[model samples]
Target: MSTATITPKGPGTLRGARLPKWSPYAIAAGSIALAVGIGLAGGLHSRVQWGLIAAILYVVGTYAIATAVEGKRQAKDRIATSLVWVAFLLAVIPLASLVWSTVARGLKVLDVYFLTHSMGVVADTEPGGGIYHAILGTLEQVGLATVIAAPIGVLTAIYLVEYGRGRLSQAITFFVDVMTGIPSIVAGLFILSLMLMFDMQPFGFAGSLALAILMMPVVVRSTEEMLKLVPNELREASLALGVPKWRTILKVVLPTSIGGITTGIMLSIARITGETAPVLLLVWGNAFINANPFEGAQASLPLYIYQQYANSAGSGAAYDRAWAASLTLIAFVMLLNLVARGIARWKAPKTGR
Candidate 1:
């Protein structure tokens, strides 16, 4: 009988490669050490500053350490991971600063009375006013804008994705691309000019019209992307069932794209919510809270911020109110984002159990 030769495979031959036991621990230790080192060295009083320094140091140290341990090929991936974290940290900084600044200043004026009261009785020279009017204007204008833009945007997207392949479609697409970058002031001016031609006086409706224009291209682009993501097989299957094309689109296509469409619409709303020029040039503003968008001047959050800062006396109370209003605006945007996320999650396609 011949003795069979046994051979052992190298560690690299494992189908699922395992990380070295010390690698992660080494990386963590290096990150923590560098973070603490830099943070302490910076001598900053603010916790935000300390956290930022720590984050930056952690990433740099981790990358350097990863490069030493991993071969150059793997080291590139490690460097990329570190860079992504750095980018994430950079984005977080301004968001954190905004929140902190708003909270610190807003706390001085965020009483229950502040939320319910308007600026009607408050003197411009004095302080202790509220943003009830501004809040109402923001809600009505943004709500009306959504109502106006949603149908047009969804239809345009449908046309582009389904029937658009030629010159007309290309023209529409090109215009939409151009409109995406049109200055906010240009939208305001366009609405102003259109209203002037109709001999209509400036009103909240004009502001709403301008906002809708601002919102439309964003909605169209976003909806187009979502519609394009729908598999052609779904469309073919629907047609195979003897369904009308419009019916198939209304049922199968729209339902499949609804989640993303909703997300896009929400984003579009956010995009135009803070627009000041359109509202200022069109609706103007009023101190009293007005529920109707058609009849009178209205004040929104951005306009309110502008008015308070520009018109208010140097009283601490006025400054406090401005900060509080800013906080409320930020809160509204955050809430919308959360709701959009929830809708997207709930409406996501179901897979196998």
Candidate 2:
């Protein structure tokens, strides 16, 4: 007897059609065109409304087309990917618009004269004043705040990660969490209340104190996370070499995590740099330069912008100054971020090649 040979199909035999890589771009372009047509027909004047309509159409159209061509399972996956891209665009568009607006409006009056001179005698309606006073005050207050906050924050983080135990550690963690959620205004108010009790006047140091309050919790949180990332084996190995616990931590733990710690500190500073309410309540914005942070009222970029805009009374010059100051503040924060990234990269521990 002879038996016929039989063959079975492999799992790889089945495959489905896929949309091209350029399909998303085509869909997005079509969605924008349709959205614009709808906006024009409906007499919708707001670009924001047009964008919202476009985003919605893009998501819906992507899913519909995918389902039609590639069945339900593939369509669901495509929908998810499309949603993520839509969300990214939604976030980026506003930020791009804001940066563009600030740059465009700021260039009108931003020049060397504007940078060197303070408000000194310039009237709100007049065009010649600069942010010198605000810049000086910002540097002093932020410097003092960093001095006060960084060590305390780093120490607290060390204790929590290395030495903390029992109810005390829990309490400390609870308070840290509470402080993290406290509003900038509330921190300012807390310091303001202390100043009121002492009958103290507004000064740059007071604003620094409020900023320190905000900075500490962020520093603590970031440092704690970074320290935790340090391998326990490093600590064990150090201890095996007859090193004291504190020395091991200082030499091994901190160095290993220093890059992350520095980045976090810089980010925390950036967070506080934009605060207006705290500085307004504590620093009591000054029109002229005040070099002394501890003794007298001082200005900050946020306060300067607010005062310029509020006191403008429809003055074009004041509006221009406000926009220029905003641009400068943005540049400062961006620089800090760049520096932080650079430091992190430079100090990052080398691994196997």
Candidate 3:
């Protein structure tokens, strides 16, 4: 009876030890302190160097500590995570530094007056002038380029994504890719060559033509990707309801992807906004405000910044103005990005509806 009732004991569970929640923070702090000590001892003056050392130390320390407390598998996982965090911090540090430097240097001269007045009758060495003319030209040139690029780009994208069938589509795609990589200087040169042939002078519209050249490929690529993301089921449903292909595309496909399309267009605009070479070659920077883009040379923000810096010849006033203009350009691009995001959110398709 005893032999019949005998049972084996269950196997005991083996649990690996885990690191505490605060271990990563503790490791990071220690690594930073050690890095600072090493920097001071080694006479390393660069903060970037110190950060790089700290990042290395953190990764190594994490892996070693994790290996001691947990198993090799857990240690490897922590190392991967630590590396990712290190990479993220490395990226963020430079961006933060750039923003900090720009804001600090730009605030010395940036003001309402700086934004509202033009550099009229004021020498680069003088203390007073503004970006009014530059802003006007920038707006006009970018607007004209947008007007030229958006519709053509969108239509090209539609044909490629919706109706493209053969070698023509493939050739278009290849050319678009080629255009995307063409340098701003090259685009300017191309337009300059055309203008030379026609005996035309530098004007805002000339800059617009170069910018449009740069912008079109970006818009076409973005719109094509967005259109491709529209569900084929939507197209089929519309077709089943006796809707023509064009109407279905206009009503269904476009609405579904309008958010993305608008964001893409805005991003393209931002990309061309900071171009200096094209504007310098085509717009031929003006000191006074010019209202008409077609008739005369215009001053754009990029060209203004460049001209200020180049003509300053170590003048503090011109340098300050350059910094201020840079800040304004950055602000303009940031505003465009914010507006793009807002538009995208507003136009995003509602799943609940």
Candidate 4:
């Protein structure tokens, strides 16, 4: 252990080496090219197989190059980075393809007339129909479900966060967790059992009830987390100022967490928006317009999409309509997410002067 060996330019001491940032891109390109060549030689027809091969080559190449030039630690870090990028591409490519395909096919018949009119008089095999009835039913049913589920969910969250303790709280928590995983079909069946007991027919309101059941746990969990995030100091300060616990929660706590709660509620609505099984079991889907959700079976977007695809899919008009409806549903969910983001931004606490 001579002091000379520890010096930067001394012999018997290792010199540090590092790869340039562009090394990753270079490696990736080379890996892809090599993979293509290998695939061609091996007679591999699947593009998926080629992509996987390229990813494997990229990761292995990164590790080997980094280990040679840098060290084992840097090599391991590069391997992890490559794996993350691979995972990200795996998640994104399918979604991008789905959106592109939906848009391409849906544009064929997704005009103003298609959106504004209904399939009331149009035959299933005919080339002209619309989703107006389904849209109306969807809006009404989802709106009703939100109204039913949101307040109950918020109240339950409030109770759990502010007042919960002992066996009662544990029971409530247990049930909420259980409900979170309950299948959409089970919720539909539960609502259907009630309808059967009352000897009632399918209606949009029944579908709303089923959707509400599905939305509740999501809302509860999200609201509960938001509530828990509110600072305890605020509660104590309000109580010290002679404010009631209820008033403190209403004024200080709920306001602080309202943005998150609203976002959660919107997300919950989005979650239930695409549920077809519940709507099929409870609403029964009417081709004809049924303006009264309480009186008769009502069409919904999910149900309409399912009916089109199941009954007459890939046949002239039905296939086009199904793609259009799917696009519409995707748009609706996207809009909900956008709205949630907007609301969350609007209601977020202002931090700067």
lDDT of 2 by residue, 1-353 (tens): 11112234347856565667678888889999999999999999998899999999998988888876666998899899989998998899889999999999998888888877899899989988999999889888988999999999999999999999999989999999999999999999999999999999999999999999999999999999999999999999999999999999999999999999999999999998998999999999998899999988999999999999999999999999999999989999999999999999988998958
Off by over 4 Å in 1: 1-64, 198-200
Q: lDDT tens string, model 3, 114-155?
A: 999999889998999999999999999999999999999999
TM-scores, all models, native as reference: 0.84, 0.94, 0.95, 0.95
For residues 6-44, what per-residue lDDT tens digits would candidate 4 score against the true structure? 224347766656677578888889899999999999999
Compared with the true structure, what per-residue lDDT tens digits does model 1 show for residues 56-153? 66566555554554446666776677678678867987989888999998888887788778999887667777888888889899889889998999
Question: Candidate 2: which stretches are off by over 4 Å?
Answer: 1-12
Among the numbered candidates, top lDDT falls to 3
Candidate models: Cα lDDT each: 0.82, 0.92, 0.93, 0.92
Worst 10 residues of 1 by lDDT: 1-10
* Model 4 residue 110 lDDT score: 98
For model 4, the stretches where C-alpha displacement exceeds 4 angstroms are 1-15
Instruction: Give the true-structure RMSD of model 2.
Output: 6.3
Q: Candidate 3 overall Cα lDDT vs. reference?
A: 0.93
